[model samples]
Target: MMNNKISVREVLVEDAKALLQIIPIIDKETEFTLRGEGEFRLSLHEEESFIRNILAEPRSVMFVASCNDNIVGSLGFRGNNLTRYKHTGEFGMGILKQYWGQGIGTMLIEHLLSWSEAHDIRKINLKVVETNIRAIKLYERFGFEIEGVQKNEVKIADQYYNLLSMGKFI
Candidate 1:
């Protein structure tokens, strides 16, 4: 349920091409959200490979927000593993330029939390840009607490930006 327009559903393997159309939108967000981060902007081929990888992983999931069957946004959750931390998960979500400021992101997070709980995942974590105050606030609303900070963690173009680690427990 989002803006009474968008619908969230499991991402399909064939959706790789459709998802590619949203690349420019994600790129713009990454410019700010992942600035000073040595992040790789995925090419179509690379993204397709990633889609395949996600599809193959049983403990990972991908969801997309669609309106009239057109992809508008996406979110993903992957189970974390470090032997002692097998009950944890990491999540990420993104909305298209036109869809930002809507309630989609929060709704997506809600869905993910519910999904995680049902799957027996006890904790969920996310790394956000320190400058992304709006996002940080939203996550707080959902009960995520600031766990710590990784200062100058991302080297974007020429600068290193700080990252805030946030987590929520079920």
Candidate 2:
């Protein structure tokens, strides 16, 4: 078990470098994410710009989890500014392999929920690979319902996998 307390906070421009390092590591550790190993190639300047943009958008937010001052997880929500879609947003998250089962995911979700409620977000959505049962269960536990499935949404190693679209209304 991890003895260090994990802290989750909004991403800062200064985190760009650390994010560049950790994101690809997480990608390499899990097939559940869309990007494969060594596929995350955001340059430091691009990452900093992205962070600035996210911060400037009132309906969008990104959070990072740190333990012992090291970033180990990240979560982000992106919402549309259009009137028709302003109340809903989609979120994505990732955690380092060593930090799995350490409640970091739970903290991130809780923070997102609180932030969504305060920001007038009515619904939250996420997509997960169908075979990722652990993630599916976690979403379900948080009251997200599987709204639909996309067949063969992802191809890996010459095999196809389905994707589950899940949502929760705040």
Candidate 3:
């Protein structure tokens, strides 16, 4: 059954401790992600500082998904700072390996779309490893279209993979 109890909300500064523990785990769990296993080496204090800074940014938003009070996923948007690119935002997300295919990613994307539109973001962009068909399909379902592909953009364990650049105009 789907975990209807999963709760998603904007991340808070106080959530840093729990986030620090989970971020690296989630990063290592997904080969489709930019970071490979054990590459996320941020310390607790650094994570807290980063979280505080992100929370303070008016153009940025980060949300976490939790089930039974345990965090399982994260989605974030980083808006371009230059006035020329203010209307564009970049997205990044990851869910625990165990939670894959459970619809949590869809929930996060839906929330992101609603939030981005409300914030006056005109374009939302994301890069997906070409081999990650699941993620590509998910983005396509949410109206994101592939704009181009960067050949050999991602190298994992000495093997390179293309990266698909996608964007959604709201």
Q: Which has the greatest TM-score?
A: 2
Q: Write the per-residue lDDT of candidate 1 for residues 11-126, one digit (tens) a residue.
A: 87778888877755676655555422334466778888888888787667788887667888888888865778878888877777777777778778877877777777888999
Task: Give TM per candidate.
Answer: 0.84, 0.98, 0.95
lDDT per residue (tens digit) for residues 11-125 in model 2? 9999999999999989988999989888888899999999999999999999999998899999999998999999999999999999998888989999999999999999999
Put the candidates in TM-score order, highest first: 2, 3, 1
**Which pairs of residues have clashing backbones in candidate 3?**
none
Residue-pair clashes per candidate, as listed?
5, 0, 0
TM-score, cand. 2: 0.98
Off by over 4 Å in 3: 1-4
Give the least accurate 10-residue stretch of model 2, judged by summed lDDT: 1-10
Q: Output the lDDT of residue 95, model 2.
A: 97
**Model 3 error, position 29 (Å):** 1.8
- lDDT against the true structure, each candidate: 0.78, 0.94, 0.88
lDDT of 3 by residue, 19-69 (tens): 878878887777887788788888888988888888888888999998878
